[model samples]
Target chain A: MSHIIKPILYSYWRSSCSWRVRIALNLKEIPYDIKPVSLIKSGGEQHSNEFRDINPMEQVPAMHIDGVTLVESLSIMYYLEETRPQRPLLPPDFIKRAKVREICEVIASGIQPLQNLTVLIHVGEEKKNEWAKHWINRGFRAVEKLLSSSAGKYCVGDEITLADCCLIPQVFNARRFHVDLRPFPIILRIDRELENHPCFRSAHPSNQPDCPPEAIK
Target chain B: MSHIIKPILYSYWRSSCSWRVRIALNLKEIPYDIKPVSLIKSGGEQHSNEFRDINPMEQVPAMHIDGVTLVESLSIMYYLEETRPQRPLLPPDFIKRAKVREICEVIASGIQPLQNLTVLIHVGEEKKNEWAKHWINRGFRAVEKLLSSSAGKYCVGDEITLADCCLIPQVFNARRFHVDLRPFPIILRIDRELENHPCFRSAHPSNQPDCPPEAIK
Candidate 1:
């Protein structure tokens, strides 16, 4: 095992991917430090060469832990779950585990990246919000159905699994973009129940140290 | 352990995400049957309500294994690894494992979803090729850099890891969209080396049962 090293997360308050990692850390109750990387300030600090050295992809939620620096939000969460393995974030059963991962991918790949900052820049001003809503709604429609079968108090049968880590952040993002959450009662219901679940509540963007003043309001 | 069950993979020949799952199955030497879900013929068989019962996401690469249906290619691959751990697709070391996942997410979420069939329809006629090329090239640029420090004969080392599962498919798709490969020598080199590798070769779209006649040529 790697030495008992302190974990440092490079994060931005509003990045959904960043929030995913935050939720996982809280779920596991790991003591960690946060270094905020403002996604919008000074033409996006993530694009700076210094941050690029930490994560070549230049994305927030880059983490230093267990003697390695890791990038990619879902990847970081999975790594934490694998190494820590206590207060387990993934279900032990293979089938339920797969379902948990299925939900994570739906948000991580299907929805989040489609609305990523880089893609939106290329999409240009005209279609940015349209593109976010297009993919988020398209993904949410599938997710709402997927959750109907697996969701209980959380995304996978009352456990605060990795899927819930993914869901809370994404639902938070959806409301930010005004994607209209009313159509998905199951999702809204789950989010409502998770409003102050402690693990997820602390990870909410509004609670982050670097969360913008206006964002808090 | 769950009963010894015959795996049934719901897949499409040309879907890169499906290719990721197929390659993993082939690598593990798992004997699984493929149920074709045509993404193109008659407006996508995956959209049928019957198919939706199988996968609410209406996407190919869902799998039925160990008496449960699993959706999302990455989830399916991870489940196989957890349940059948013989030919492991992830490295043992935590850092290498994180790197492998980072690469997969880069392709799965960062690249694949941006150019997904559903998103392409929204991108429309004029920007279709541009959009594909734009995102593929952008992602490849980041991937090429990530691969520099980690890659050997394969994506994460000499061993065939999950990252390779993702890279081959994304590279193939890049070629389909005419994304220039001249700059990404590491990616091209890896793809060139994988050309005749049994796992990837057998899983290629052209080798699949449902590969279109034109695609075969």
Candidate 2:
């Protein structure tokens, strides 16, 4: 077994995607130090030379575990699951594992990337928020269908798998964009259930170390 | 093992992302039928009511395997890996599997979504190709750095993994967009090697059932 050293998570408070990882880390009871990377101020601190050295993509939620540095929230979460293994986030069976991963992929690949702040910037300021709402709503609708088939109290058969970790953050972003949740009853139910979980509530954007007061207001 | 029924892949010939799954299916020796969903002509068949029934997102490359339906290329690929374990596309060890998935995510999540045709449509026609080239180059550069640390004969190790499956299609798209590949030597080398492989060549857009004559020109 690898030595238990507290991992360091480099993240931004308002980044709902980063909030997902924080919840995951807490759920696994894995202690980690936080290094908040301000995404909005100074034209994105993640773009700085030093931060880019840690993550070439210059994205937040980069994790340093043991001696190795990991980038991408999904990758970091998977690594923790593998290295830790006690509190398993993925199912044991291969088929179930694939299903869990599928739900996660739908959010991580199909949804989150399109609605990211950087991509919104490229879409132009006038339509940025609208673009975010459009993609987030589109993604949530599809997620609603998948949840209709696969979800059970959580994204995949009731356990707090990696899919849930990916889902809550996206829902948070959706609400921020003012997407109507009435259309997605399944997603709303899942999000409501997840919100009450201690790990998830503690890691909410409003509770983060770097969350801006104005944004909350 | 379950009965080996012929799989059906609903995809478009020119869709670079769909082409990734095509290569994987071929590499795994899985025989399947190709059902074309033309992205052009009458503003995309993917948006039609019929296709939307199969895929709520109305996206290409949705697979029908052994009576189960799967969407998202990464998810479908993982499903294939699970159902057909003989030809493993992922490493056996946990960390190695996570690394291969990380590389795949960087392309699938980070690169491919940004330059998707739908996203480009919003950017306007004149800037569409430019948008594709910029994001492809950005993604390729990141792949170059990742491959520098992890690659050998392939993206992860000597054998072909999911990372290689993703790289070939993205490289093809980059070349199509006229993004200079000379700067990414390692990525180019890997592409050259995979390009020569029978599975990849067979799955090339030019060889698909619905490939347009002009695509080869």
Candidate 3:
């Protein structure tokens, strides 16, 4: 194989989607640089023509690798799993792989989008927290129930699969919104375990270069 | 191969995610039964203990196939692709496959979730259409831009990939919410082309057994 340039990830410090990709990169032990695109700075730099050229979606977690740009966190993870092929993020068994993707979709499609910054802005400041908590609680119920059946030490079985990558960030968002976590003991437990893991620890929002001083503990 | 029973899909007639799986099943030529779980009937049969037992997520497009159940449309599609592997939904080339998934995530995660029935319900009666249209338009712009580079006769290329399956249902939703398609000629064109394709036609919401009389043309 030809020598490939190190990937560059265009990410936002607090973006859950970006954080998922960050964890995947670390787990794969891929050397990459973060070119932070502040989502909150100057009313969102993602909307600029420059970033739009990189990802027409103007979304964070867009990655430039292997001479092409990739957008969407789950899609980027899939690319990494295929290209890197080390520290595999998805299980080999078809059913287990499907289960991993199932957990991912539950968070990627079902949970995160509804409570994202865009949606919250539209939800308005008056009812934002209530709206965020409502959706987060509804989604976490599904995640907890899913984890009950599939989880072991991580989200699916004892292996730290892509499901773990998706789960941790959303759990962070749930806490950020002040959604009660008591109902999701499995999720809470898995999150606690993952928080201590080096990959997850390094990828956390508070550790990102763009993380504000106030956000650090 | 061992003798396999036909899959049973727990789906709602007009649910876009369910429709995406329906199209994939048709494309694969897989014989299946639809056990319609009405989303609106009696406060949603999907929320019942019976349905919850099948899918803890309490969402439709759950499939009981190959002695295991699968939830999430994209996950089920991945299962179908891996297990069946007849008429392939994803391309063999890695980058092309990533592109297909990028489009899928654009709809599944970015667009469809924000405008889903649950979100609209929370957005409330008065502001529902406005909210739905707002999200659909934002997501559509991103999709249209992506399609500008990827689309040929279909979403990703000339072939009807998984991206097409995700695209058609979303275009239907965009129409449902009265999102202006004038700015998204590529998306509109692809939707028009796919609407008449046999696989897309048979799997359409209007063609579903559970479709109501008023929904039919």
Which number leads on TM-score?
3
Q: For candidate 1, lDDT tens digit of each residue in B1-217? A: 4545679999999999999999999999889999999998888899998998998878888888887889999998999899889899999988899999999998998889888887788889888989989888878988999999899999999999999999999999999998889999999999999989998999999999999888795
- The residue-by-residue lDDT of candidate 2 on A84-167, one tens digit each, is 887789988766677687778778878888888888787789988888888887878778887788888888887888889889
* Lowest summed lDDT window (length 10), candidate 1 chain A: A1-10
How far is B26's C-alpha from truth in model 1 (Å)? 0.9
Worst 10 residues of 2 chain B by lDDT: B1-10
The TM-score of the first chain in every model comes to 0.96, 0.95, 0.98
Judged by DockQ cut-offs, the docking class of candidate 2 is medium
Error of 3 at B151 (Å): 1.2
Worst 10 residues of 1 chain B by lDDT: B1-10
Model 1: lDDT of residue A180: 92
Off by over 4 Å in 1: A1-4, B1-4
Better of 1 and 2 by lDDT: 1
Rank the candidate models, highest TM-score first: 3, 1, 2
**TM-scores of all predicted structures:** 0.96, 0.95, 0.98
